[model samples]
Target: MLFRQLFDPETSTYTYLVADEGNGEAALIDPVLARVDRDRRLIEELGLTLEYAIETHLHADHVTGGGKLRELTGCQTVIPEKAPATCADRVLQDGEVLQIGEIPVRAIATWGHTDSHMAYLVNRDRVLTGDSLLIRGCGRTDFQSGDAGTLYDSISQRLFALPDETLVYPGHDYRGYTVSTIGEEKRFNPRLARRDRSDFIELMANLNLPHPQRIAEALPANAQCGCLSETP
Candidate 1:
């Protein structure tokens, strides 16, 4: 297996590249539009054929590179079945497995930050949590049809059930931490650690965080797979 974790300083987004070294086929998860060229260059340098550009949800912070990557590499664009984004080539349901060469990436419906958010479980060892679960704090549940209680349940029952050693890679990390394990988050996460559903809900409800800076431009653009000119 070949893997690389790329970061975007502008949005604090993390883009992942994973491939099967044997077959030289790969997938890009949650790619940022601004970094598409860099990502493409890396993929080319690594001698991998880009097969899929997958989104965890319709992000409100940054436009996606799925459309551009598809145009550049002919990779299919994939998103959660329930997401408002209708431009995806494939809409994946929970538990559906997407094969990138020999790797099996399972889509896990872990809605919390948004109504249809998903996390990808790669080879059953690492989980790519898209805003649903973060390092110490989770995503703010204040907009885009967010529900605090639902998010609490998703993390506690779904994500926390993974093996204690399962690696956690989050969508964005503002605090500079790169990765954590399920066990570490379960024991130390300030928001969910030892907190009951009610407690978790209460914590999210009062965050009072401001809306994403790019929401106005990002939402519409993301809905169309990063076509900024398309109307929402």
Candidate 2:
């Protein structure tokens, strides 16, 4: 399997391109519109055919390039089953697996950041954890379907339970820390280190950080797989 992880510093978001080298087929996870050209160029350079573009959730930050990629490469666009999108070619369920060439992509339902959030587990070793888990902290459960208890379960039971060596790549991060092992986060993340759930919730709720300014525009756009203004 061949994988390319691309990061956007402005949004602190990471986009991934995973492929089966032998078959030259690939999938893009959580892509950003601003970097679409670069992503496509990479695919072309690698001689990989874009097979699918998967969204972890309806983004509240930057618009996704899933639609543009599909228009350019004719790849399938996939999102969670309950998503209110018209462009979701494949409404994936929990544990649904698809073949990107030969590598199996497993979709894990992780609804906290949003009601329909999902984390993609690639080949059982790497997880595209959207907004569920970050390198040194967990995503704030203050907007949308953000729930403290549910976020706890998503992290403790669903994600943290993975192997210690499983690589965790989150949707967004403010700090420079790019990635971490599941075990590393379990032992070190300041937010997850707290044993008291109430404290964690309180801390998250009290933070006054402003909501993503582009949310109003991004959600609908993301729902349409990046073409909110266009008719499919």
Candidate 3:
């Protein structure tokens, strides 16, 4: 298996390229539109054919590169089945395994940040944890279809149950922490470490983060991978 973790400093987002080095067939996860060209260049440089561009959920920060990848390479778009987006070529169900150059990637439902949010488990050791889990904290449950209590359950019940050695790759993290082990996060993440559901909710409520500037504009476009009919 081959992997590359790309970060967009502006939005603190992470894009990933996972491929089978044996055959050069690859897939991208949660890519950023602003850096699509760079990612495409790397794909070409590696002599890999892009097979799929996956989005864990509709983003509220920046536009997604899934559609642009499709436009450029004719790659298929994979997303969760519950997503409201119509552009996904494949709707993934929990426990479904997708083959990428012979490697099996399993989909895990993690609905907290959004009702349709998902986490991709690769070979049972690495997880693409969209917005559900981060290095020192987790995603805010104040957004669309988000419930604080539900988020708590998703973490303790679903993610925390995984093996301690499993590696985690989150969607966005601004603190420069790229990746972490499930055990490390479980024992150290300020929010999850406490194992207190009510405390987590209270912390989120007090964050007072301003609504994302492009949220309204980004959602509809992101849902469809920025293929919205409106002008940009």
Candidate 4:
């Protein structure tokens, strides 16, 4: 498998590129709208064909590039089953796999940051956790149908259950950290480590995080797969 992690400095968002080295078939996960051209060019330079642009959920931070990617590459736009993106070309349910060449990307339902969200486990090794789990912290559960209790369950019961060796690639990171192992997070994450469900819930409730700057514009555009009624 071939994998590359790209970052959007403005939003602290991370977009991932995954491909089969042998087949040169590729997919981009959690693509940000402003970085579509860069991602498209990189895929071209890598001698790969874009097959899918996948979204973990309807984002509130930045607009997605999925709609524009489809226009640019004729790739399908994929979203988690319960996401409100009716414009998506494909909707994946929990445990369903999207095959990119010889690689298998399995969607794990981890809904808390949003009512519908997924973490993609690529090649059974690394997991791209989109806004569900971050480095040493988890996503804020205060909006977009977010619930602290539900988020706690999803993290403890779904994500933390993965093998300790699994690599975690989060959707966004503000602290400049690139990657972490599930084991490391299990042992060190301030939000989850040794914290019971109730404690976790209370902590999340008191985070007092300010809403994303782009929420008003992002949510509506994201609902249409980030089209803004037309590909930008």
- Write down the worst ten-residue block by lDDT for model 1: 223-232
Q: Which residue pairs of candidate 2 clash?
A: none
TM-score of 2: 0.95
lDDT of 2 at 165: 98
lDDT of 2 by residue, 60-137 (tens): 899999999999999998888787788778889988998897898888888776788899899889998999888888
What is the TM-score ranking, best to worst?
1, 4, 3, 2
TM-score, predicted candidate 1 vs. hidden true structure: 0.98
Can you write out model 3's per-residue Cα lDDT over 113-149, one digit (the tens) per residue? 8888889998678999999998888888788888777
- Give candidate 3's whole-model lDDT: 0.88
Query: What do the candidate models score in CA lDDT, each in turn?
Result: 0.93, 0.86, 0.88, 0.93
Q: After superposition, how far is residue 15 of candidate 2 from its true place, in Å?
A: 0.3
Candidate 4 lDDT tens digits, 1-232: 8999999999999999999989899999999999999999999999999999999899999999999999989999999988986899999999999999989999999988988999999999999999998999999989999988888888888888999999999999999999998999999999999999889888988889899999988999999989775557
Local accuracy of candidate 1 as per-residue lDDT tens digits, 15-47: 999899999999999999999999999999989
Identify the runs in model 2 with alpha carbons over 4 angstroms from their true place. Answer: 228-232
